[model samples]
Target: MTEQHAFSSKVLQEDCLDYTPFLSSVTLARRRAARLVSEWGHPDIAGDVALVVSELAGNALLHGRVLGQLFRVQLILTAAAVRIEVGDACGERRPEVRNPAQDEKFGRGMVIVDALATRWGVVPRTVGKTVWAEIDLR
Candidate 1:
């Protein structure tokens, strides 16, 4: 599968559950999604998608994760591009690109994602919004 990601990739999809207010699990899932894309012979692109997933997943957890609610991470790799989607139990917040000052030690994840992704957007979900990004593989 990884090889295919590197060479002639097919559609790739993976799901990971979001537990309590934690980040370790989501991080691993994003890496796995990257690995799947790498298998398709697109390690570089996979890495890009993985990073986006990481940031989005983190955002989902940080700003969207709520009490008694769970978040979900999904990665899709098509022939033309790779898409990353992260959904959480949020309904009152939004994501935007920010510029972090020199002293700031956090809050720059989305900037990186926005720079790498060819296209990105947000979609309304039952609970919250699904933040997504697409990276061209061709």
Candidate 2:
């Protein structure tokens, strides 16, 4: 049997936005991701996309922020999948999935991201890094 890929190389639809590294930006990113996925005719995955966007964007704001720099969110839809990417201006920091204590209030963002996306990874950019997650449509 042939192995099925989670995402196609050909992009069918794409949307991108840049936001200031602020707390509100994470909410905006989540909303935008859900709307874009729904508009692209994949409402079933909208909630998952939104959740992943929230985690990635929140991580960028909290750990990857640089003064005067904005974090960017990009959504790319293919026939078989949707990919969400959050780019920030700090390459030195990398995202990690941590298992926090039961009473801990934070450190669960990457854990959520890891559980939701079919596949996720970081791509190093010239000045920073782009954290990306993909959800399969099939």
Candidate 3:
């Protein structure tokens, strides 16, 4: 039997945004990430991942409180899994998981992501932190 090739790709690097309003840029980045995953035969996972990226990136922009540091988003797919990575210049701060009541508005993002992601974590780089999540594709 012939072996099927795995797929992996890196985004062209988006420009960082000011931490004032966090809508347009975050949405755009999430869309691109979703599209990349969809091409790898996981459109279902893409939606959940899109939201995860949005929330993580949003937090980085809104709460991490850094300036002029463009974020990097990367997608990697293999026979067993698909991985999403979002890197920002907020190495000093790590993201915290929160639990909210059924009627609560905030703190729900990470909860949803945790439920969907097979694995997730925050990795510190020399200058920043990378928030990553992985979904099983099998």
Best by TM-score: 2
Candidate 3 C-alpha lDDT tens digits along 1-138: 012223354433222323333457788878877887787667978888788778877877766646766776666676767676777787877766786787986777667777787777877788888777777775
Q: What is the Cα-based lDDT of residue 1 in candidate 2?
A: 10
Question: What's the TM for model 1?
Answer: 0.82
Off-target runs (Cα >4 Å) in candidate 3 are: 1-22, 101-104
* 46: Cα error in model 1, Å: 1.9
By TM-score, the better pick of 2 and 3 is 2
Assess candidate 3 and give its TM-score to the true structure: 0.76
Q: Could you report the Cα RMSD, in angstroms, for every candidate shown?
A: 6.5, 3.8, 7.3
Output the worst ten-in-a-row residue range by lDDT, candidate 1: 1-10
Q: What count of clashes does model 1 give?
A: 17
Q: Candidate 1 on 1-138: residue-level lDDT in tens?
A: 001123245666545455455878666777777887888678877777787888888888789978887777776767788777778778678788888898998889878987998878777767688777778876
Q: Name the runs in model 2 displaced over 4 angstroms.
A: 1-8
Ranked by TM-score, the better of candidates 1 and 3 is 1
Error of model 1, residue 9, in angstroms: 14
